[model samples]
Target: MSKNSKDTLKISGIDTSVLRIALGTWAIGGWQWGGPDDGNAIKTIHKAIDNGINLIDTAPIYGFGHSEEIVGQALKGKREKIVIATKAALNWTDDKEKIFRDARPERIRKEIEDSLRRLKTDYIDLYQIHWPDDKTSIEETAMELEKLRQEGKIKAVGVSNFSVEQMKSIQHFTQLSAIQPPYNLFEREIENDVLPYAKEHSLAVLCYGPLCRGLLSGKMIKDRVFQGDDLRKTDPKFSTSVFDNYLAATEELTQFAKDTHNKTLLALAVRWVLDQYQGNIPLWGARKPEQIEGIRDALGWSLSANDLKTIDEILAKHIKNPISPEFMAPPNR
Candidate 1:
């Protein structure tokens, strides 16, 4: 790809700069990941934008609106230069501790307004349903999103955590611009169908957790302990024998990166996701400015067929017990 062409991805008639990678604000929300410092989080967002990353993916549930607020503050006068992608249909209890999925018409209506306010934008570049609510018909949700699109509140409509069947059901009501799903070397359930469907339909694939929630970052150690609220504490992949298996795989993957490309496992992991599938955008999450530094290394590199085969062999050799991220799914209400 040419330098200019590689720097941007056109989806739904909007050109989003892919110069670095899309910045993910889930960690800055400071809920499941850990506590976050507002100053650091804001600086991290600035650093990402300064470094040429122009796409940001956030959700209202992320820190219960805190992430959007931070994003709004970060983009104070630069909103037009960046593309904001936020989600809806996921709400919290009155106390704001528990969260559930609700995509009813009334609920989505309220969510868009609230998200617009928190994001400090009159219109969102991309609005997505955070999850598939079992209680609401997919058509109903799609209709509401289509209504918003018509009204100019949102420029494009997308869905996250949706299956191929779910996307098909929603497509009957409105054209999908993108699909956000958890995709990385470890979690690849989408590769079977969702990916092919998106490609066939010309919908962009915005992949979340590109580093497997930091597992593929190559920073995790077997003795590491997570706080009570940390999502990884309860993640099956982090438990006893499973944690060891994953760690072993990471060790091998790290060596492969050094031997092959002289790059960090973090860069290798992100590059793997981007190269494995065409037009697959990885949402790289960061809470500190330093965490955003390695994005440069992730670019300008492509994995060869032999490199991909070696990665598969490494995964198959050490990961005797593979775990899925099913636990992160919210309850349908």
Candidate 2:
């Protein structure tokens, strides 16, 4: 693959240069983030694509397929300009309360058709397994995904929230070219294993949650109540004492960003992620058009080694007892 720009990545089988940042649609799905507004969601999608972001990272379980429906609606005319990426392997019941892993071959067959219909596209640029299904062998899932590729339903096979061993298992069976793992300033667990492995294997790495679920955005006010179905309500980081730690870190980080880099905390967080690995594309989540504006700040600069050290020192100063995002994983049934 040939890349002409440092700001873009050449994903396998795709001719276009995918932007270094992707639009994450989980928040707009309105499932775990409260609820969705179709009009604004459509606007946000258009704005991101129009602003030069060519990659969209979404999933079937997000808002129970509502997000894809909106994405389908938004991409009616701009379809060719965007590299639509969505995921499967997770299933949900009618009550909207229970969701679990289900990567049976039969399930993936149905998932491709359903996703194609919902996305209003004849082919998907990338099809990803959302999570590892303990009940289904990785080889079984890879064979089914490879079948879809053979049928021209999907251009490339990808995996999310998967370990290096699981990814190797998929490679043993068929093509596995891309991987999406939780990666951000505070959540850098992938650096130890996934990043090195992906870099060695020439796999695309789409790092999600660059803003750490909006915590790095420097907008979460103290004592703010996240009512409704907001995931923050139960997130361990947002609990009383821990939240105070985050609050202080956010404030200091915000000041550090403004004073040192003349950038917002959101931009600092995103650029930090991108600088970790030149090819690493951080997925930025946004539910509104205004939320997309700050991304411009993230791209125009690079962080220095000294600055990185200072940032780490600041995080260590306040964010004691840091946590990972593993709690959000769905149980395999």
Leading candidate by lDDT: 2
In order of listing, the candidates' clash counts read: 0, 0
Error of 1 at 170 (Å): 0.7
lDDT of 1 at 263: 96
C-alpha lDDT (0 to 100) for residue 146 of candidate 2 = 89
Lowest summed lDDT window (length 10), candidate 2: 1-10
- For each of the candidates, the C-alpha root-mean-square deviation to the true structure, in angstroms, is 1.6, 2.1
TM-score of 1: 0.97
TM-score of each: 0.97, 0.97
lDDT of 2 by residue, 1-333 (tens): 113266688898777779898999999899988889888999999889877799998899989899889899999988888899999899987897899999999999888889899999999999999999999998889999988898899999999999999998899988887999999878888989999999898889989888888799878888788879888887888866788888898899899999998999998999898888877889989999988897678886788999999999988999877899988899887
TM-score of 2: 0.97
